[model samples]
Every structure is written in structure tokens, then in C-alpha cells.
Target: MAISIFGLLEVMLLFINAVAILNEERFLAKIGWGRQAANPYEQESVKARIVNLITAVSTLMRIPLIGLNIIVILYLVVLG
Candidate 1:
């Protein structure tokens, strides 16, 4: 019973790590795309504000996700 539980925990950890890596890659891609898109919007004031606002909001939402991820990793490492 104990061994099965540990096996499950290890699987969960692998899944979480994969998800974190994918999210990081997607985020970096989005930032790169945003940077490339800036030049085209240089003459547009309203569009720039909207784009910046969206980016800011998305970044804010990621804070809790990152924190939770860290906590989960610590829990798995120390207790599992």
C-alpha cells in the first residue's frame, strides 16, 4: 500500500513538471510575439493600452499559479 502511494505521488510530480515546462514555454513565446508586435502599434495609442493591459492582467494571474507550484513541489520533496 505504501509503495503504491509513493508511485502515485511520483507520477503526479512528473505530470506537474511537464505542465510547468509547457506553460513556461508558452509564456516565453507570448512575450516574444508581443515584442515583435510592438513596432506595428507604435502609431496606435488605444491599441497599445489594450495590449499592455492584457499582458499585465495575465502576468498578475500567473503569480498565484507560480506560488502554488512552488508549495506543491516543496510538499512533494519533503514529505513524499
Candidate 2:
């Protein structure tokens, strides 16, 4: 059914988003902007703060997205 197809598509897109987020984190770390390298002086920079904020928001969003993906997969399996 169309609903089932759409659910599958959503799952694929969510998976891609998760991968992209991971890649973003990796890229940030490679560029010396990772969360682990935080220091008092590093926090003073507007650019560093902005990057940290964006990373935090993306990571938070990813949690709910992963849960939604699981729920969608269950729904598709049970009702598709």
C-alpha cells in the first residue's frame, strides 16, 4: 500500500540523516571543533559556541528520530 511504501521511504531517509549527523560529528572532530576539545578559551569564541549549539541540537533531534524510525518499522511490519 502507499502508506507502507511511504513508511519505508521515511525509514530510509531517517537512516540517511543519522549517517549524515555522524559524519558531521566526525568532520567537526577532525577540524578541532569537537565536543571533547572544549576549554574555557574555546567557549569564548562566537563561532565555537555556534558550532557547539548546532551539534547539540542535531544530536538531540537524532534521538527522537531514531525512536520514530523504530516505531515506523514496527508499524510497517505489523500492518503493512
TM-score of each: 0.30, 0.40
Overall lDDT per candidate, in order of appearance? 0.57, 0.69
Q: Which tens-of-lDDT digit does each residue in 1-80 have in candidate 2?
A: 35666766787767656544765455877876666656668677876785677576676777777777698779779988
> How well does candidate 2 match the true structure, expressed as C-alpha RMSD?
5.9
Q: Candidate 2 local accuracy as lDDT?
A: 0.69
Prediction 1 TM-score vs. true: 0.30
Candidate 1's displacement at residue 78, Å, is: 0.3
Report the C-alpha lDDT of model 1 over 1-80, residue by residue, as the tens digit: 36677577657655554444443235644765343455664746665555555455456645655666687679878997
The clash count for each model shown is: 0, 0
